[model samples]
Target: MGSPLVSRGFQEFGSALQERRLRLLLAGRSGTGKSATGNSILQRKHFLSRLAATAVTRACATGSCRWASGDVEVLDTPDLFSPEVAQADPGFEERGRCYLLSAPGPHAVLLVTQLGRFTAQDLRAWRGVKALFGAGIAARTIVVFTRREDLAGGSLQQYVRDTDNRALRELVAECGGRCCAFDNRAADGEREAQVRELMGLVEELVRDQGGAPYTNDVYRLAQTLGGLSREERLRRVAERLAAHRELWPLAGFPSWAWPPCWALCCCCAFSAGTCPRR
Candidate 1:
């Protein structure tokens, strides 16, 4: 292995090769506020919101957002239990399987659900998610309970402590006891706190995986990529290269040339435009 710093650069380069941006797939039941949570994280209304009874999201919707540290490529998926999606795509389960196997592959997976009712259905949904995404993903997953203000008297900790929701407790334990509550309806100091906590958790998880410490530059790059569409990213890269070309006409070449000139008694002229081999 190379030095830690060099190894980290290689890992980041590998990640970039896979896709120029880190992809996080957000998943949950319909009306669980998964989309709302996404919008909250992105700090913009990117995903479509609806107050319907059934699954509003029929397919995957992707959005990008820039953070102080990095770019976030969030894929808001349809409810795992959406009948239309399941029926339409025979490969849906396979896709879910891939996600499960590759997860935490995402820097993080935000499992959003509403507050108040921790029903058996909800428990089953959580189980399904784990079953599909795989147990490893849970280690990087955070349970973000939306509409947190619904918990009348205390913090989310107190609520969790008081509830007899065994499945929820198990889910939390499985995810390394990482949980956060968010009120997507409003912005507050708590929301910022939650984001910071999530970022810290992500950093810790990546480090535990023997990865390099997350840096501001990496995060900035991610943020820049996150805010762009596929076409836009390519376009920007092209533009940047064009600008660089203007700034440095022979950037990669050195001031020398050889061979033919060596045979022609023009060695001094060759030295003006080519590099000396090491």
Candidate 2:
């Protein structure tokens, strides 16, 4: 018989592969090892990775790599929550682009950060996600931590277990305690092993959420119908979507402004996981 580790890997990979198409959205700050995390998952340099003071990915970009089951796509983005961008975008203009790229909605939204470096910016990013996607989207989030090597033979779960950082604990708790870690620098098969663990978590999330992807209408309801019951919110969400479809024909953008806005948006490369691999 196969070892437990091998069996677990198979299960994890299977869970992700079961989906007709798996869409993973990676969102986080630029220097948080965000891009590298995607590269590690693909086990290739699919997204650009570097150190910079400002945001590197200014648009929403998606790259797909083949897994045994089929193609897995990862969407990377800039700081969609940045104060400058938020004032003008206000969840409508920019969000439409994200919705377009991820389509129906992403199956898993991976919030990336560095281990031991969850900063104020990180917290803001999390808040931005909830504000932008609405609080209900929290169920689909998985906190991915990069730079696993920094643990120095320690595990992030162990650190969380022992640390008194109240904010960090609450952050993880809000994510339903789902976490994944990636070394990013690992050159061996260890990378594959790490990704399998992540897929396993994705599978668990799907089961818990009854296999429903976070949809565009759900995103709309999240932003518009807060403080209402789920049933009412969903009903209103349907109405709003129906209205948009009916009115979309009459709505036209100013020729000059539309191009750049659409182009810039097409361009937030908008862009983790939890603890290190064992």
Candidate 3:
């Protein structure tokens, strides 16, 4: 309505209004470009994604940056579904760290994987997410395909529809028809477009859910406890947390707020909601 600078500033401000702060949890098996996807979303190389003999992400890594539209927090996790990570060691500490990093919750859970790279491990990974977060998470999830340049001339929607991989296709369908492709190697101009498109998808998801993030029973219970007296609530939370004896004395957790903190951590790990860092 005013000068060019003023108009441009207003546009950016409106975009931010359409989408404010978002917490994105990246999940997939190793080598699925989870970190790379996070880097692309941040428009920088914050998370490492180089090829390695073993898994590169041993812990849950977090990266946050302000985009033209709004702020985004990316939580990149290791292969939580792998037999080694799931059964043998389970990395409760790593999972707990990721949950704690997310804080209150996460908005959308991005199940990242390379285009045409869905395998048995990926399927297991999906199951693992369901196990931890509950069946309702599928609705709040988005299947993100990385390495889009290798898709030839085909579109991501077409690939999702035409792919012969039943499991992968079903996975996409389960997420309320939400999916996107990211060309992390694209030029600067193209990369920006891709990120913006992805943001649009995220905004649509948030809108569809009535602008509320996803949460499970554990998280809801923790929230309910917040209304109680501090001493009583902490006592109840501590009693409930006892069920997860293996996760007791959460690594790096404050000793004073162990009960509620653990409850929040568990809720964070298993919910698809935005964890407000601020």
Highest TM-score among the candidates is held by which one?
A: 3
CA RMSD per model (angstroms): 25.6, 12.7, 12.7
Residues 1-278 of candidate 1 have per-residue lDDT tens digits of 11111234334543534233445567666778888777766667889886887778766677776543345567787755332333444444333332332233566677777776544445545654554444456766778888777765468876666565555677777878777787777655666555555555555555565543222222233346646675554444334333333322221222253222222221122342462311
Q: Give the lowest summed-lDDT range of ten residues in model 2.
A: 259-268
Query: Model 3 over residues 140-206: C-alpha lDDT tens digits?
Result: 7888888888777688888778765666778888888888898888998878777767777777787
Ranking by lDDT: 3, 2, 1
Q: Which stretches of candidate 1 lie over 4 Å from their true place?
A: 1-22, 81-88, 93-104, 188-190, 212-278
Give me the runs in candidate 3 sitting further than 4 Å from their true place.
Answer: 1-20, 87-91, 220-278
What 10-residue stretch in candidate 3 is worst by lDDT?
1-10
Cα lDDT tens digits, model 2, 1-278, are: 12222245444554554355678899765678778888776667878888876667767778877654445678887776433444544434444556556766788899998776665556656766665565777888999988888778787788766655555678889898999888988866778778878877877786676656686554544565557775665455544444444223222223443222212221122221222210
Question: What are the runs in model 2 whose C-alpha is more than 4 Å off?
Answer: 1-19, 87-92, 216-278
How do all models score by TM-score?
0.61, 0.71, 0.73
Please give the TM-score that candidate 1 achieves against the real structure.
0.61
lDDT of 3 at 211: 57
